[model samples]
Target: MDDSQKRETQQRLQSCLPQIHEIHSICQTPSITFGVVHNGEVIFKHSIGHRDAQQTLPANDETIYMIGSCSKMFTSAAVGILVDEGKLSWTDPIRKYVPEFDPVDDPRIGQEADIIDCLRHSTGLSPPSMLCLGPGGTILTDEEDLIPLLNVMPAVDGEGKERFNREWIYNNYVVGLVALIVQRVSGQRFADFVRGRILDPLGMRRTAVRRSDLGGDGNVAAPCVKKSNGRFHGLSDESWPCEEYTPLLAATGMRSCLNDMLTWCIAVLDAERSENDSSYQSQVPNNPLKQMTRVRRGYWTRPADDPEFSKDAAYGMGWFRADIPSSMLSAFSGNGFSREKEYRLHLQHILGKGSEAAPFQVVGHTGGMRGSIFSVFTFPETQSAIVTMTNGRDFGDASDFTAQLLIQALFDMKPTLDLASWARTEAQLAGSNYQKHIERPWRENRHLGDLERDPLLYVGDYRSFNGRFTLSIGGVADGWSTNLSVKFNHRNASECPLVFYRKDVYSFYQVDEDKWKIQQIGAREYKQMLLKFQVDEGGNSVEGLWWQWDADTKPAWFENVRNRNSTQKGAPFLVKSYSG
Candidate 1:
């Protein structure tokens, strides 16, 4: 590296070191590794922090962090490899592979959601996590896969279309379904398939599906947690779901060291001037998967156009594509996982905290657990990427602030201190006017006359994928709980918990009858009802759209809400019922 570049790196590190060090002062974060690649050469490679705070075991070059949803790219790349070898077709419907396919609330709809729908997250159903784990509940899969999801109904939007297909919301059930497809078609389990297809071939020695595979390597960093006092705390626990969480293996189960992560990033930003045109090749005759980073789906985003509030432009396979000025390569935030969506909250804002698509495009992903935060950055034009993982979660500042400030320092940009101050000020103003925010009227329910008219015919217990939330009339809770239920003995095997976002309005749409199922809760507690109950007249088959409390606010992935001492963390927030 040039001396000038070294100086620049030092300056950037110095600017952010205080905050990061302050975080370390509270509790030493697990090992952190950083790798910088520019112009086809790795300019920087280093590891900082510890693997276990109490043990004082140091993290080194090979220590791995749970990459979580970043594995989507790996999954997609594996699928591409399979497709290249002529094992599966991209357009094939999931049912063609997993015939047990059938969504409950709208038996007609779930069966029809396709494989591409699963990858692009357009399946009508709200993601399984949105319903099963998003609220406080145990995940159904030993490997993190959603079992019997064909049974659960998806959430519907105001227009009655499947809310997930519309918004690209959380839905691991569909994602797991893809894993099933990979297994059935490739003759291998999803984890083995990816490892065999991609990792092993690429020589990703430090990556693995099981945590035990990591051995006693203390190079990995623990999760970072922000205490109520706004101080960051990092604790070490050698045992975690990465080793035990299996059901959604495709979702958030893999762990890898920095060396492997850096190598993976190099392949991603493979913007070689002369990339191979043929398949099975890279820009420098390397793997062609690198070029697949562009937006796969053109122009459209799910649920609606971009959210009125969030400017999410489009979703490409598992990657979120945000249109930014000046940069051709789109950017995306990495995804994550949690068995009990509510176990501990983490608001994932750091991934998108860098430059908002400007002179330099900021595209990266974020992963977190306990308090650890992992980041992967790619500057395609420069063939440069930075991977930072820290186990310490506290630093008087939020993760995004710490990360973006660091990024700005790297780019030599003047990250104004008052940039967030305005929002904080506005927040204070709104807080001062708290009654106004509280005065917003909640949505009222519409009559399900169609279901009511055909009531007796469709009144029996209906089931969907995640265990059914029954619609029984005998004795159902009145507030927020929808008598959504599940029974194994049910004639239709697709019975599982289902929640509705809004049944009344969903009944009016034409996209897919059951796709827009609402959670049973009224609009008061939730933004809208997300699931609904319905019975199939053909064979006493029952179904309903189901949902769990999404609890997460718009941008925060999982807000560690109990930390009230931190003004940002302490601000009062309510958990909304899943109403799509």
Candidate 2:
């Protein structure tokens, strides 16, 4: 591209500022830092909103934000490095490195699943529901405990069957297992390995794999979320800090700045370009970037009528591959700010003119955590990329929408619909629906009245079938009210009062404090856990309780193991005392 084309591109991007600001304001996002990379160089950079909840600190190029699952690319690259060295092969079975990794649900999965199967998400493992942390918002089990828990975990089909190499199920635990393999094989901590091999080499000095490594960096953006009141609130540092994510660090615990991320993107784009050159030999043998970006599984197919049309959308090791239609380019003709009219015109103005309706391939990934989200796109054919990072979550898919808008602008693709309106409407509907879903049980069954047995009978220690989790029910007295609440892993901080829904079922909502502390980060949809008590054969004594935590699969059973001596015959059994 010549100077004239570059100026024109800049002008088009400049025209997008108003729309970007409008979306940011509407979403109530705390901050967004983005950059565009063209021909191996950063062509444009911009930042909006504030880095802090107080709105005193301005976000800029140097403000660091957690990239969340975007760290998967780095982990895959680390594995690729091992492959290049012949230290391990992608075909190697997981049991080879971790002998204890035997899933009892499907012994064949434990015996047959190879590295590629896990990376490609074809291992058939159900998505991990409560594996990362206990109800207290802290790491419960360590590396050793993960293996045994996984042994009894259900498959994607909810039956003890294997889907290995057949279906795609996004399992973060399996990816964490891959990182563990990297640690064991490379003989270095996962964080240390990634920093030395990838971050240092690429000169991403601002990137840190662990929070401890960040060490007094005042420029780091505070994780936050926008509330219904249209205000941003910063989450507590202890909520879900990087340190607590040690076991899954490789999966989702890297913090980086716009400048550093742009550097990383350039490296990936350069690697892809070099691979296409027959005469170009990489200094690093076998080049993991090629393997990481190579499409391995097809996940979706969008028809031509779709606004962001793509015939085939697939997943590689960590990146997603898709094609954008070329015919969506047209001219802009509209006036001022209207959700329907303005967005369409803005999109058209950026797109410029329509040409042949062809499609071009692009690869990237989207990541989210408690209060941060990211979207990255690399147009290998054009040697360009877009990286967007925001320090807010749950309000909407602000980062992703921004990336899509930029992609259309860069490629001169016209607007097929009012994307901004669509995104905002969807977000609002999702939040509203989720609130109703959680309240449905109570709303429907409240008239059924309390349980037949004493509520104290449910008080006890309950353990999961696999013994991976423990729940304790106890009485809490606040002011004049006394109620029974359950706590995960016996942590007092995680306790939530149990409300009677029906005769044998009781419901409780977790993370209420976290919800008030921040604006519902991490959890896109709030849910309530229901517990159903089981009576012994005589129907006089409590035996166990069935827990319905995740609504997707079967409810897990937890045996009540209260000691007989802990409670006297019919008085309120107060095993533990809590003050108001």
Candidate 3:
């Protein structure tokens, strides 16, 4: 591209900035920073909104925000590096390295599935509620906890299947396991590998595996949650310790700034040249990046009922691919500009997709965790990319919307949809009837006798295969009030008196409100819906406790390991009780 073309593109992109700002404002986002990568350089970059709700500090390009699941792309690249070195293969069985990851019982996908199956999310695994233990109840801190998941195979609608072939399941646990594989093969910590290989080579100085690595600099943007009242509050747990999320570090634990992120995108966009670039020789090979960005999986058919599935999209190793039809672009533009029409024709002529074929291909990913949201996209053929990050929780599709607008603007095409109006509507819907700890009303149809079961029968130590949490029930000083205790992992171990809210429903009010109050499997079911104890033939001894939440969310069962008549801290219990 020549200077005239570059100048024209910049002017068109500049025209879209005001609309971007309007969307950010209407959506009540605390802060947002966006950059446009054209012809191997970030020609247009802008940062808007305040760093915090106080509106005291203005955000800039240097402010670092958590990139969340976009970190998966880095992990996929790391695997590509391994594959390039002949150290691992995408078709290699996961059990080849991690013996604990054997899915032998699942007749359908166990033996046939390989490492690539995980990268493309063909493992048929879904997000497990038990694994989410971090802020916003969506992140995991332990790698060892992943072992128990082998016992529980991926199921569609709660039934084991003969095969899981077509459907896509977005799973973090599988990605976490991939990080472990990287560790086992590379003989180095995952974070160390990413920093030494990916970040250092690309001159991504502002990027780090953990927040503490960057230190307590005010340059790092604080994670903030937007309340229904159009206010923002800082997250209580400011730092996400990397050691706490060893396996998950590759899945979601990346922190970066606009400049570094732009550099990363440029490196990806110019992968062919970078393969021979001496700057990347000693650190990361570009061959891995080339493999990482190529499409490896296909998901063309959208759900029949889903109205949002109008476009065709697929998944690469860690990135997503979408084929944008020129006809659709024409419709979005309302046949407004002759330049846009010409540009659309140019794309059709180059990609061999005329007015009838899909003219453009977009590849990128979106990420979010707690108060941080990020999006990164690059047109491999056009040499254009967009990277945006905001300090807001509900920034899911907002990134895609912004990227689309910018892409359309680059071509000088007018957008048909009202993005600002859509964002405002989303904000209103998010704030609509915001309530804390939503639970269902008690079912009064149960017999009173059944409700008055022997409290002693429920007092025992129940355990799951994960061993992350232990459910313990013990008698109180009065022997009347049931004492409930939960030892979850090494970090959270607490006990409290069980407040009987309904028949077989107990609430541990002692748990932090933020952790439990915000934990909802569904719109109606809250965390207060404790285990419904399963009884034996005579209904005397308890066998197990089934979590009776909606099957669509928060589904797990704990079998009674021991029925100790007394809640002793030692002997059969073999676990420390929470003193508090």
Candidate 4:
């Protein structure tokens, strides 16, 4: 495009900046850095808000932020590189490399599923609760530690035949296993291999696979949480240690800045061009890019009436592929400043009236963690990309919403719905509902009487059926009274005081202040952490316990070990002897 066209596009993008700022303010996001890549170059870039909670340091293009789960594509690229070197095959059985790769409920998955099945998330294994791998949880720091625990992590209950290669369950544990395979087959650490093969080659000097690499970098954005008072607070390193997440680093641990990410996006776009036209030279090779973006599982089919929405939505190796209506120089035929029509008028102001454009293929991925969120959209057909990253994970989908707004403006697509109003309403509802859910248990059970038996009877060490994880119930003094609190494995930081609900069931919310703060910011896991105790025959003693770790799945039962001499430590049982 000529200078006039570039100037028009820049002005149009500039007009959308106010809306971006409005959304960021509405969502209470701490920081955001976004850019648009066109024809293998960054044509537009913008940054808003502060990198720190104090609002002292302004976030810029160079401010580094954690790109959670967005690291999946890099892992996929690494695997593709291995395939290109003939070091591994997509069809090879996962068990061929890791002998302990077995699912407790379905051993056949380990025996039959291949590398592609795992990469495409077709193994029918739900992603395990990250709490299970927390500091004192079952899994250790090393990637290899996941192998033995894999056999105990249950598969989706009803997905029998589909568990092999039919369903898309998005298992991070499996991805970590894939990384381990990369490490073993390539004879190098997964992070080192990715650094040498992908990051260094692309000149992404600011990007690093390990959080420790960014230790002394003062330019890094601090992860933040928006509290109930509508203010952002930065979390300390001890509260949200990125290192404890090492086992799944290949799946979620990656830190990068806007400029480097833009460069990465351009390389992907250039690779797409090179794949189509042999004469076109790409800065990066086409082999891994082609393999990484190839769709392997269908997850969504657009409604027939929604012409502007995504269609045939599917998951590729790590990216999501969809066909969206794209246009150039389209005019707006509507009135008013409401979300529905105003976006179109904004488009018409930029690209004067023209015909509707054809549909274009778009591939992208979203990454989210405790206090960070990211979104990237690559228009392969148009050779353009849009990326947005934010330090605060708020009640709304701020990152994706900002990216979608940009996509609408850049493509000049006709307005089909009011995105801004819809997002705001949804965020409001989610926040309200979450607040209600958090209070419901205490509200409903406040009238119930005390426990039938002494709470000390339930104090013991309980091990899961597979003996992979342990939970210890101990006593905590509250004024003159003592209450029972439970901790997973031996993590004192995760200990929560149990509230008596009924005869044998009790509930507890996250006691860790940082985790509770994260839930306030919409993390939404463990809103109701219930524990049910089993009574032995004749009700003489506590025999077992069941824990509801995930709200969606059935409670996992653990046998009462009563092993006083066990290596794990817990508060001494109070009121030594209990009447039976």
Q: Flag the better candidate by TM-score, 1 or 4.
A: 4
On residues 363-389, what C-alpha lDDT tens digit does candidate 3 reach at each position? 777776666678887776666788888
Question: For each candidate, what is the lDDT?
Answer: 0.46, 0.65, 0.60, 0.66
Kindly provide the TM-score of model 3 when superposed on the true structure, using C-alpha atoms.
0.78
Query: Per-residue lDDT tens digits of candidate 1, residues 1-580?
Result: 5879867776665656565444334333444556555655565555556666453667777776666666666666666666667777677777788777766545544556666677776665645453333111223333422445435444566565555445655555566677767888888767677766667766787787756556674455655443334433453333343334433556555677777877776666552233423343344334445335432333245331223323444555555444322121212221111111441112222223344544444455565444455666566555666676655432221233344445555555542332243223322342222122212221234333433222232233322223232222222454754343332213122233433223321221112211211111111233322333333466343333232333332211112222122333211111323333
Question: What would the per-residue lDDT of candidate 2 be over residues 1-580, giving only the tens digit for each residue?
Answer: 8989988887777766777787676556788888898766788899998899888899999888888777788877888778868898878999999888877656778899887777767777665445445443455556666666666666646453466666677777788788889889989888888878888877778887866666685888888866666676776555333543444676777788999888888778767667576685554343335443333233332222224532545667777766654222111001112224424333333232254656677777877766778878887777788888888755566786677667766766664233577456635643444455444534654535554556766777877645556778887666665578877765555666786667766766532443533423122223336677777777667766776555455566676666333332211111222121
Clashes of 4: 0
lDDT score, candidate 3 = 0.60
Give TM-scores for every candidate, taking all chains together and pairing residue i with residue i: 0.60, 0.84, 0.78, 0.84
Better of 1 and 3 by lDDT: 3
Error of 4 at 348 (Å): 19
| Candidate with more favorable, higher lDDT: 2 or 3 | 2
